[model samples]
Target: MAYISYLDLPKHWGLERGDRVLLTSDIMQLMFTTMRNGERFDRDAFLDAILGVIGEEGTLLIPTFNWDFCHGVAFDYHKTPCKTGALGGFALSRPDFRRTQHPLYSFAVAGKDQQLLCDMQNVSSFGVDSPFGYLEKNHGKNVIIGIHYTDCFTFVHHCEEVCGVDTYRFSKTFTGQYIDAEGQESTRSYSMLVRSYELYEATDLTLIGEKMERAGVAHVIVLNEIPYRIVDLTAAAPVICDDIKNNSSRGICKHKLQ
Candidate 1:
């Protein structure tokens, strides 16, 4: 396998200037095909490639989610660590990037919206005030790398929450000790729309992703044997909301909550 430079990311990812993108990716694959000075994976080059294309106008959001807060553990703003993937850790290591405050669902944001995103008072993990909501307000793009949208796409929970789908899921609160960036500690409570697993089966989004693909909002591409799906959340949100509104059972989950 040959190497592709950072210059090739924009064309392959279908990025444009001033675009706000949410990246759910597996960056470890870079080790297989990319190397910086023959030492390790060219992760920095990967970020540089995306940033170069997005320019000063575009904003990049990488999920820095750590779920220890839900397990009654204290969340350290600076060191709780990202359980999602290598991309979040990489972004957190950069000086220009700033992380949002939601301990379970925070994001490492960069570019034009860095301050705007970091400034959010993350009171909820998936509410109107959450980073997910702000991104939806801006109609951001959901970019999946080395994975399929069905396998991920937590953004749909935002749709389900706003659209009101308590039939299958309901809002739940998790309170824990939160350690701030300034090293202050306090007890805090956050909300997430968790599944009613006892009533219905686990949420499956395979069908929903297919629906978006058919609606022409979700697109799939392959580069260097890695699969990528880019969903225009702005265009696809309506499709999901409509499905949930008309047929909640058919929208995301397989079984109807009883």
Candidate 2:
């Protein structure tokens, strides 16, 4: 029960240089964590510590997902705000971080692969062409802060979509006005695998993480008394997609489907 300094993060979190990390966090859960080496926590300092450890060779992506575009609302790539959390807004506020282009599921990206991530123009929100797919193929990790990943692993939908899970989800498209970096506007469309009400209530991705930890692909780590899960998307996607394909429970849902 001790306050941990930012410099000690690598030892506890296993963050290394040249790594690619996609993070989703609940920053409110960190409000009480002002004690950093007997001084108040500086958000920028925390980010610097992580980015410094990862170095310019690594990449950090913070989810800035805004669903307004999914509902036919216009999405401004430069102006629309983050609806996910404060961490995303913080990333958005940083000059070093650039936002991705997918309206419904964009991220604020920094470090080495920033341009590549910002350049992504995926047709489907969770398909192989999306950032989720990049994380899966590029040896990226899904990092969770202050919350259990089961509650926020949007990547699960990516697996279901790519695996063509027909029982519990269906592809749906939304069209809206999109404003790009050049200030040009155009009507564009995006697809997402919407959950089916006929199938099951909710997905249970606990098993996916369990399988990974058991196989030693990844593990949950704690830093400064906060639970953080940094699991390889490459490793976890297989477990999820396979279950989506053959699990009688219909892609690891809360209840079995008849």
Candidate number achieving the greatest lDDT relative to the actual structure: 1
| Per-residue lDDT over 148-232 for candidate 1, one digit per residue giving the tens place of the 0 to 100 score | 6656799888888889878668888999999998999999998888877766676678888889999999888777666789988
lDDT of 1 at 96: 77
Q: Each candidate's lDDT (Cα)?
A: 0.81, 0.80
Which residue pairs collide, candidate 2?
A: none
- True-vs-predicted CA distance for residue 181, candidate 1, Å: 1.3
- After superposing candidate 2, which stretches have Cα over 4 Å from the reference? 35-37, 249-251, 255-258
| Model 2 global lDDT (CA atoms, 0 to 1) | 0.80
